[model samples]
Target: MKLSAETLADLHPEISRPAYDRSKVTAGILHVGLGNFHRAHQAIYIDDLLARGGSEEWGILGAGVMPADAQMRDGLKAQDCLYTVLEQDASGDKGRVIGSMTDFAPVSPNHEGILRAMASPSIRIVSLTVTEGGYFVSAETGGFNPDHPAIQADIANPGKPGTIFGAIVEGLRARREAGMVPFTVMSCDNVPHNGEVTRAAVLGIARGQDASLADWIDDKVAFPNGMVDRITPATTEARINHLREAFGLEDARPVFCEPFRQWVLEDKFTDGRPALEEVGVQFVPDVTPYEHMKIRILNGGHAMIAYPGALLGLTYAHDAMAHPLVRGFLEKVETTEVIPIVPPVPDTSLTAYFELIEERFANPRVEDTLSRLCLDGSNRQPKFIVPSAADCLKAGRSIDGLALASALWCRYCFGEGEHHEEIPPNDPSWDRLKEASRVARDNPAAWLQMSDIYGDVGQSPLFREGFTKALNALWENGTEATLQAYLND
Candidate 1:
């Protein structure tokens, strides 16, 4: 089957497709980043909600903000905005064709179409999955960078926007002028307090233009902080071919993820929202406890293994987890240092949650790439790993493992692994990082002195001392031996 609305009925009998009429599904949400995570997580949830009936009006209207997003727009548009989502784990595989997205607006030169779509009264939610760097946040200040080129361009020509936040502000401005209720801005990224992060970015852009408009937005808009979880790997050619050969299905942008999924959101919306509660989306009063727990355990765990895995030339996350030294470092750091400060979830056990993360990381079938985990270290380190180190330092707790993790990141930027093999560029700030790593090879303090990444926390003597020792060990010895030394110490 070609996996279009027309050929969907001809798909394998076991494959699940949409049961409701696609025509009836209206645009109630306009998502900015139409990436694999959004497709696998939120789109799936909305798809499930629609299948249960009475939510046809809440369908998603996908929008692509970046120039690179045109590829996704074309791929989904070719198939009537339909795509396959394959979930794999030890338990089994479940393939579903998600039809939650009705269409994707073209990534215009000036983003006119996107602005119009955002201003639509039907769209009650304007969501985002633009990565941590996409928000134009400075790691040093922990705030929006007003000097970001894209934001500046958007502000200069307020009528025609450049970035997602620009488009969002324009959309909100238009809505306000039309006497309409503003849509809620939802952020589904892995960043801590993602909703607040998004709110700050949007407000940062809006306030730059007009202080009164910023005040109105500050009063009217609802940015709900939420916790989202799902391990979705990039869709490779091999996986795409497997979909075609195994299920007689062919799609351009199919998504692959672990069977496990979770979404805990704050029950705050400016406009009327869907009954996602009926389909297992937890709508709670607070999402901080859940957010911190996941950030420290799941995301922090990924960071703990990523650099070491890359340094060892490991290809997949599961393979990294299978290595005794690699898994030992992760387990030791997560348990002794990381998990100690994790806030209590309502009824969820932290130990059990960590166990689940371990299982997900080690799922061989998922084959989540170590490179994917290792990407964007400069932006990711401040968000994922540094928090644990800062918390441990603040609480006067042991931070050896956390320091080792940071050292591994700096060494990984040295652009080589064991046997001196070439490690490809990973972070957006790779050149600056590699330059610092080379300098720090002789004087390890140079790496920590990166005020942009480490900020004030990098100034702490405790972390500085530990990071220096780890970086030196990694240079003289190898990753495996250095990890062993840490464990033995």
Candidate 2:
């Protein structure tokens, strides 16, 4: 049967459903992006909290500013904002219906509904999981890009704002005018120092509209930095069908993820928040250590494998992990280069953390895609991989494996996979990256000159020489042989 509020009672007794009464739950959080990751991760936590017989006021009102979000709204509405989360592991699969999300606003051009939802006094927290690139950070300065076209448009027309930040600013303005307290603007994206980046974007947009309002927001509002980790792959038709076959349930927007999930949040909210610590969330004074550890080892490990995996035409992440060369390259690079620069995280050993990451990547049932990991290199490489490389360079550490990873990125951008299949447009700067890759085939320095990506690290003689050798090896010897050289060295 189709899963909905009405069908909750009829589902298989084995399938987990909400223990708390969904009817009594009220909206206290307005989450901006209703993507699979947020659904499988944050919503699940809230669901767990409510099931424990409390936090009834902390239900989620899902909102989206982007045009693509309209489809999500439709899907969620069809299911009565109740969807399935299929957690897969070596043991088996378990299914649960998440009831934390009460409703989703219709995606609109002006985003009037979303603004009103955010401005509501009852909504104390405005959380977001928009991807890393959605923050409008400058590649050159690594700060808010005030000159971005969307920001410019929002500045000119403040009342009818077009971007997410614009909507947020307008919402905050309405609350201020209504004499209501501002909501905490928490960013749940994968970027390092996500709360700070969120604060910069919101303040930058607010400053363009009214300096006084920006000051008020800066003084009153809270943006808590957080680190969220979950391997929730994009849902496929087969996955949806699997829900039907496995549990006799039909869910339009089911989420399939690995069994593991984590959220480390800085404990700073303006009004109040759900007692998330009651669940598995770690409330910390500082999320930096945890953030650095996960971003460097787990996220960086993904970067280490993604390009070469895609070039070699591996489909699933576990398939790449199973390959001897790919596994060896990841082990060598992370241990020798990336982990050495990572600062110590409390209650965690970097070596054990890497082992956990390897185990997660090798989860066969999760089926995380190599192409998904390989997407948006322009944004991800900076956040995930390049900072480690830059730190290694600054510390005068060997960057041989790191350089090879960068070279693989450049080669992957050549609009062809290892089997010469046509690589779709994966990056925002595809043309430039492709041209640079073509040029660097002859002179390796050509790719590094794209300072927006490589920055001064490319100019380092050690990095340059290592990158040159890696690029040449990739071209002359192929990915497997190149990986062997890095491994054997």
Candidate 3:
């Protein structure tokens, strides 16, 4: 049967809340980019709070600013805004029906609805999961790009919004006009200083439209930096079938994720937020150290493995980790190069962190695909890997392993090999990157010249020499031999 409150109550007899009454206890918390990660992490936490008779203050009001999110909006609306989240880990898999999302404002076309929702006093916390790219940042300057066509369009037609930042600014403007308190903007993406980044994006657009409003937002709004981690892979038909068979429910948008979930936020919310702290959320004075640690270690390690594994024709992260060379590369690069550069992580040992990462990678049940990690290499590498390489270089240390990792990326971007497996198009700049790599093999200097993508790494003699060497070896000797050489070194 299709999943609903009654169906859920019947399937999970022990749940204390009657399925029908679950919707009545929700309050509005506007959520952008209603993707799998938000559904699994934040929605689940709020659902747990409601389950304990603790919250009627934080129900998610789902909003989607992109065309891709239209499907999610339709699926959630079909099920009364309720869906299942299946947690898969090494231990096993368990399904929980999440009911914390109350309503949907399809923002792809209905820009007015989004602005109204955000301005609503009921929406005390405006949370986002709009991946790193959505911020429209100039990767070179690490700042907002006002010259972007989308930003230009949004600024030109402020009343009819086209971007999330535009929508946020319009909402904040309305709140100010109506004499209402400003909403707290919480970023749940994996980018560093996500809150500050978002604030810049929002305020950057607002300043172009109205400088006074921008100043008002700067003074009144709370953009809490956050560290959010959960490995929720994109859902497929096979997963839907698995959920149906496992739980006797035909939920179309059931989320599948690893059992691990973590959220660390800077404690700054203005309009009163969820008692999420009561249900295991970590509210800290500063999220920078934790952010750096996770971004560099966990996310950076994923990038380190993705390209190398993909070129070697390995499909999943665990499978890649199972290979001795891939595992060793991960260990050497992470422990030797990556971790030393990162500031201390809170309350935990780096050894233990690496151990946990290895275990997570080895969880075959999650099937974290290498290609998933490999997507948008141009965007991912600068944030995830290049900084570590830079830090090591500044310290007069070797990043030979890191360089090899990057060379593997350059090879992967070539998009073809003897196997003839077509690399799926994932990057907005894929065509340019592919063409650039083709020329780069003959003249490594040509590739590094793309200042937009590679930044200082492109021009660095260290990166150039290391990249040229690694690329040449991999091209001439193949993945296994290149790996062996790196390992022996």
TM-score of each: 0.98, 0.98, 0.96
Candidate 3 per-residue lDDT, tens place, 177-246, comes to: 9999999988888888999999989988898898999999999999999999888887888888887776
Residue 350, candidate 2: alpha-carbon lDDT: 91
Residue-pair clashes per candidate, as listed?
0, 0, 0
Query: lDDT tens digits, residues 241-303, model 2?
Result: 888888899888899999999999999999988999999999999999999999989988998
Q: What is the C-alpha RMSD of each candidate to the true structure, in Å?
A: 1.0, 1.1, 1.7
Better of 1 and 3 by lDDT: 1
In candidate 3, what residue range of length 10 has the lowest lDDT sum?
A: 12-21
In order, candidate lDDTs are 0.90, 0.91, 0.82
Error of 2 at 300 (Å): 0.9
Off by over 4 Å in 3: 12-20
lDDT of 3 at 441: 78
lDDT of 1 at 174: 92
Query: In candidate 2, which residue pairs clash?
Result: none
Model 2 has an lDDT value of: 0.91
